[model samples]
Target chain A: MMAKEISKSNYLQIDPWENLRSLSKARIALGNSGGSLPTREVLSFQEDHAFTKDAIYSDLKEKELLKHLQDFKLPVYQFQTKVSDRKEYLKRPDLGKKLAETSESENGDFDILFILTDGLAADAINERAIPLLKEILPKLNDYKIGLCLVKFGRVAIGDEIAEKLNAKFTAVFIGERPGLSSPKSMGIYTTYEPRSETTDERRNCISNIHENGMSIEKAADLLQYFIKESFRRKISGVKLKASLPNQIDRK
Target chain B: MAYKFTLRGKTYSFKDLKTVLAKATPERSGDALAGIAAEDNKERIAAQYCLSEIPLKAFLDDLLIPYEKDEVTRLIIDDHDTEAFKPISSLTVAEFRDYLLSYEVDGKTLKGLAPGLIPEMVAAVSKIMRNQDLISIASKIEVVTKFRNTIGLKGHFSVRLQPNNPSDDPKGIAASIIDGLMYGCGDAVIGINPATDNPQEVSKLLKQLDDFRQQYEIPTQNCILSHLTTTFEIIDKAPVDLIFQSIGGTEKTNSSFGIDLKLLQEAYEAGKELGRGTIGNQMMYFETGQGSSLSADAHHGVDQQTLEARAYAVARKFDPFLVNTVVGFIGPEYLYDGKQIIRAALEDHFCGKLLGLPMGCDVCYTNHAEADQDDMDSLLTLLGVAGCNYIMGVPGADDIMLNYQSTSFHDAMYLRKVLNKRPAPEFEEWLLKMGIFDDQGNRKELKEQMLKLK
Candidate 1:
């Protein structure tokens, strides 16, 4: 049987700059013979999505992350959440926010409490967390600090962690929800006057700190500046503004 | 008998051919050209016919007319071409800005165009210019265009009644629509995003909304924000004014949503075949965002915001009736907080408008994100100044099923009152007829309007 004819007006128009397709990966100026993408691109996108989903589960990296803390010879504590596994952590966000029954409280009057957790992107935490801390830790060598590795945690978990540690400020370096483009992206959320149920406005977030994106030195500089400013201003988030370089010239 | 052809569906026959040529080129009256001479009129008539019937690309070939061409032929032919037909690649940002700010002609030389031809011009031009260059030009040109195909090209807005998962029932959805209309929305286009992707359910929901439009005598358009493929299958069977899809910048991202350019084209064609637009209005409705490409892993290392703009280039292809960016709804991973969200929203609006898409914004954020209504308020006001086409409307600016906060129905009213803008023409008339809006487009008595509904 002859194939059914598709009409011209049924598709998108031809993109005029289709020949310049190689310059950018963005789907621009593609010819307008509109239809679904070909099979290869479709399957590749699906595969990428699967990769993003898999980035959520990286238990093998947990051992290496803890070892890095031990090698730094900094103080470290293991904390558990009310949630049992990553599945529960994702399903019941409320459970992820609370501490486990066996979680013991430790009190230490520290300047900044750095809490590490594999929050949605474990690879982000494993790759960026220690490297970022390593760069900034020396700048604050004189200040008292507490470090803790947390499991199945959320951004708010830092508030409770800081309350128990009795820290002046809290910086939670957690893996952000991975995007298809950058699955190993990390976020550093800091808050002042740390306590449970603190409104998000009191928190400042610095995100997209991965190997390919924001460098460790810059991330470290930002986190240190935020902590210093948080202490100086007695607040974070909307109240305090981070000043950027006035001039930039891209190479 | 001289010659005859149809222009904009009207058959113009030539006996003396004066009136026919006049109809074809209203800018040049037959009498004006007639007094010149009989032979001159014939030459002008043939030129006018080609101008009216042939597209610019085809007409460019006329420059190569094998027979001797003179200065008179060039002046007569080129003068009639809409400035939009100029090879946009040669124009600098300033020149492009000037072209977009106003028609750049003495009068409405572009009156005879099919509805949504601006998209055609934008698509054609965008192909020649870099997206960044186009966006820069669009940003500099602060011109507010009427949604040219519709009544009243002034600033207009719509409230998409999102009857999410738990509230997908017809009665509940109808109640939301009533709630939206009570606050003086439904102007731009009353669209719905069904929580369920089931094609049958989507069709039923569209029918239900169409019934409400008829029962309430709503003069505006309606749609179900489902995937185009789902809508395409049911386009022939449903009362769909627009086919909706969540478009992104790359083919992979679009394909991830189970749609490709071919599917989008098919939907466009189907909507056209169904006579989706009231007149010749374009019939595609697309929603885009910054992180969707990254979310789908198709961003190819491009920044999320730039990817969002390129998606507009894709949207301009179909000459969409609406292209909205659900800016902050994607969560904190892409656009981390209020500052980032606000910046991205403004950029999305700016980029979309510059690309010549009828740009709207779902000025929204998720509970998980560190954003508040105040952030939305600031963005909404800014978008109004930037000439956004519309913004989403939900009850209290919150979608319970979708788990996000968006601009509320009252927000639309606030924008209209503050900005001194009105809804689309037909919806504006309905508002006046229902006594919801006064002649000045202010709320007459919204409490009374609600009470009447009760």
Candidate 2:
């Protein structure tokens, strides 16, 4: 049977050359960091055995500022436009940045924060977020109340709230840009010792968590490591990236 | 005038597309486009009525693959299936460096076969395909896309309609899977295993398919890949094919004999009532399960009996575009396992011979999933001796490299020459070299066997 090929909004020409430059070298290269970091000390063995490999994903921070994150959990309140139109989701990312009034009042404070959003393919949230959530939440229970858990409908990152709350770290679980093969895949990113000021570059990510990619258990473990290392070194991004390992394995 | 309000959460908005299009097109007469428009409207309405929905663009993007390659008949195995297992990720430059050294693979070699990795899989799969191969091969990637269809301006694979809550939405799920397969597969016929148990859901599926066919350009999705992609459709009509999943089996919903007879009746009545009706034109498929049941003594397994009965019933039923294939139980694994390929082929062969209908073909076991590697290879050479015209199995299901430059078989040789340069030797060899190229595209001896069955 025949079907229609509906067009979605993508400003491919917005800065075609720059887009290519960004997608390639910039997206792949670690800024100042060469993947070097202090050894993370797990306070409890109870927190071990989390996240499998396939469940990893990452993204650029929404804002451009940076800060050292001492703590992270979530209350980076999630807010989204009331509109359900796909065009609006793409056009009004600002709506995705704010915290709903009710969500703000209900959300508790935290040294860390987590926000879950239905980025491009909301269908992937379970494959990507559920496990990370399951693993990270229990581990973080030892800390202050985690960021308020609220679901939003777009692609804004955690920095918007961190900038407002002056929190230490920001973590967000969202969908990866849909791929021909992996449309409904999910990802999670976190910045160590984050402030409301951290930009996309300050965090690391774990992606491709479908039955076809990394599983959730591994994604959680990766996030756990990112958080521990972030807290320990008081840094993330190019500072921690330049001299880390021999090979990358997001195969 | 009545204004239409559709359910938004679960639909792809094809309705909106149609509505807006209709408003713009302004049909010659309202009544003229009513039937076509009404049908499209129904599917759209169903999608919108849901509380959640899959994005229509996703499905359409996928559907484009099959539409583009409607003439190629080859089977595809995407390396991406294996690549999803890799262990690296990033956001910034520093993170990428860290990703490279994120963890130790515990001294695993990138060489030799082991488990799966995500990027390598996608890379490997992409490596196997050339730009030319796009329309010639029927691909089976690991992504969720299942089949081809239209959404708006173009055709694409349908998106999966996953509901956060599991309460219901079988049609959406079913439609999404069909779309996924259609999108992922090359211009080969696509099919998906239904996600729901509802009998009515199957009908909705058929209606959607018919609607898709009615709305968009659908080239024949058959080709070398049909030998195997054909199996996907057979399995999809399980009430019809599960009867063949095992030999001699029965399912509650699809009584092979019953469905066939119903179709035959419909064809007969339609033919008499009008100038045209699908007699053999509607559609029927060849189905055979894993070789274990190829040669049964007497429809014995409860599952076996049911399947055989269903198979027999379907064959004798409406008798549309028909084909029947039995496992080519000649491989080595069948020696260890039990694949009466010869016996089953002959039985099905004999059945076809007597009925004077579509021919019956025999196949060798291929999938490592079905048998061991060497065993599948051993069966390939013997297919000639089995007196079967068709062989069904993917290439490299047996051998690591798919260099079929030597074979005289159609699909096998075609793929061998066509897929000769594929970098991923194992999958290309298995899907193309061993299965489609040999079964549908070439093979004189097998052709003779088919004649015998016919």
Candidate 3:
């Protein structure tokens, strides 16, 4: 049998800064046995690697998700972009940025288009998207809202979805890129008059929505405030700044 | 192949050295430096001066006794006419010193020298000037000696204002620089790293910085982080105070940056030919990180910490004025988070200093990395204790362009107060002259001075 060649550095037994390792989960203090990552962290890193991969490639359960939408009395529209499968969606970003020609929304006219997308981290959208939307919808009662459920989509896909819906603003709740520590983090990207021409500057981002991140109630309140401010100013992103109720408005 | 010598219990090497010599100054003439060593004795001269502070002219005149004028003239007259040696030999010891100090070689003077000489001269100097601590080669690069006085001949703890971005306008960059200066940053050099790699864009930025320096009469060096080759291409068109490059631990890792030992030697020569240092000073600003080799997939199976120390060995070969290890910037694949970052930073500083390089820490973290300002605070304080040469001075410690957190201009002020340190000598003079800070470093009238620029 061939000898197994280890990829990591040799593990050392004692590291000088091992005492300082207590402050963080970062790999610094793991005393290298010979000269590399300790066996436990190597295994732990491999496990986290598998966990992040599963979170990114996992698909949403359509029937169970639709049940939550029905329970909230939120009308949902299922849509796809030009990219047909998850593989193509990951490979071709431009395809993910536009809607498929056959796609159409029943509720086309609204003040805002709310989209929940499975971007890179599908498990995050499957677990946290609906509950956060349920809390956010009540606070956004002042505006006419349309809901779109997107599959194999990214944040930019919402720009095309909102353009088709003829909504003035778009709030895209999508899964963020999974970090080793936080696999299920979500992000909200809000844009005014989003279109193919829209750049990142036209969209405002609020991120890190998960159990370990921003709570659903706080994200809902913040999203409501941003949407309200975008409507009042007729702008978002670089031009409009977000402020808490207790803070002074920069504008 | 290691031409190693130890000073203060630490060893240093002078391998593949080309630009480690001192520039000509009024106190030391460029011709005298050229005469001190010939092509045959480069290592001998380096080993001799690597651990002693006796001025070269003094070493030759007083210490190098019974020296034949013809033999010395043979060594000194490289390209110059041998008749040039006639005036040099007849002079008394003091007159020879005066002649060497007073003469200018190609519009420049030599303040200090690392002359390439024979083993005989190296032995002579070593036998005579056996000072315990060889004054750092960095101090000899410039004429003014006060810059290294406070740190006891070690390089001062300094900060470089890194006003970075692609679309950053001149006015915006200037504001950040002013903010840093007001808070006692930019002692090392006020440098900018433009997001775009275009040579024209980088040259334009250097032009604006030169204009700013001239307008304020700022008495420190400036740079834009362009590859040394790119800098060589543009230095003729624009002024660059230092040739900036990022080096790594392994030869393979350095190769990934399109650099090798030969390229480094060539870049050093190119920088010297350009002569961009602020009036005959050393001209190299290098950055390294612990995880950079592993991040670049060139760790070569050696551990990250040992690889980082090897990078310092490369840096000291050129005797750079600044070599900053941007600790924690590479992120989690190598150094996981704050704890790792803190440990690696101290290690980098300790290792760089041990190798006789003026080591600094970026003391930075990215948002994606599990780090925050508090981690930077702890690391900065610790590195301060470790005698860090410098840290990054980004406004608010937040780089809007890179979206990373580093030490702010305010953090530098805090370090200065707590550690009883100040910026490099010239910058301290500027601060005191501007009346922004007092003799005790108390704020005299910040709003009045800073608002005037805006």
Two-chain DockQ for each candidate model: 0.02, 0.01, 0.02
Query: Tens-digit lDDT track for model 1 on B1-454?
Result: 2456554665445443223322222121112212321235344444345324334343233232121423222322343335544444344323443454454521142232212222223322332333243344444433222222362254554445443323245655555665566567766677776643446777777888788777877777788876665677777788888778887766666755666667677777777777645555677778988667655545444335544655775676677777789988776655656776766676666556654556778898754455666788888887776666778876545464454567766677778778778777667788788876678865543333244443
Top-TM-score structure, candidate number: 1
Residue B352 C-alpha lDDT in model 1: 66
Error of 3 at A26 (Å): 28
Tens digits of per-residue lDDT for model 2, B172-229: 3223222222111112222323322123433344454445433433322221111111
Docking quality level of the chain pair in candidate 2: incorrect
Candidate 1 Cα outliers beyond 4 Å, as residue runs: A1-251, B1-152, B155-165, B446-454
* lDDT (tens digit, per residue) of candidate 3 on B157-203: 67888876423345556656766666667777888875333467677
Per-residue CA lDDT of candidate 1, range A1-251, in tens? 99999986455333232343333222222221222233444455457556655666765276777888887677777788898876556545556677888878777888888899888777788777888888988899777887888888988889888877788788998887665456677888899988885755567777656543456776777778788888888988645555533111111
Query: What's the distance in Å from true for residue A178, model 1?
Result: 18
True contacts kept of each: 0.00, 0.00, 0.00
TM-scores of all candidate predictions against the true structure = 0.50, 0.26, 0.48
Find the 10 residues in a row with the least total lDDT in model 3 chain A: A242-251
Chain B only, TM-score of each candidate? 0.69, 0.31, 0.66
State residue B102's C-alpha deviation in candidate 3, in Å. 43
Query: Could you tell which candidate, 1 or 2, scores higher by lDDT?
Result: 1
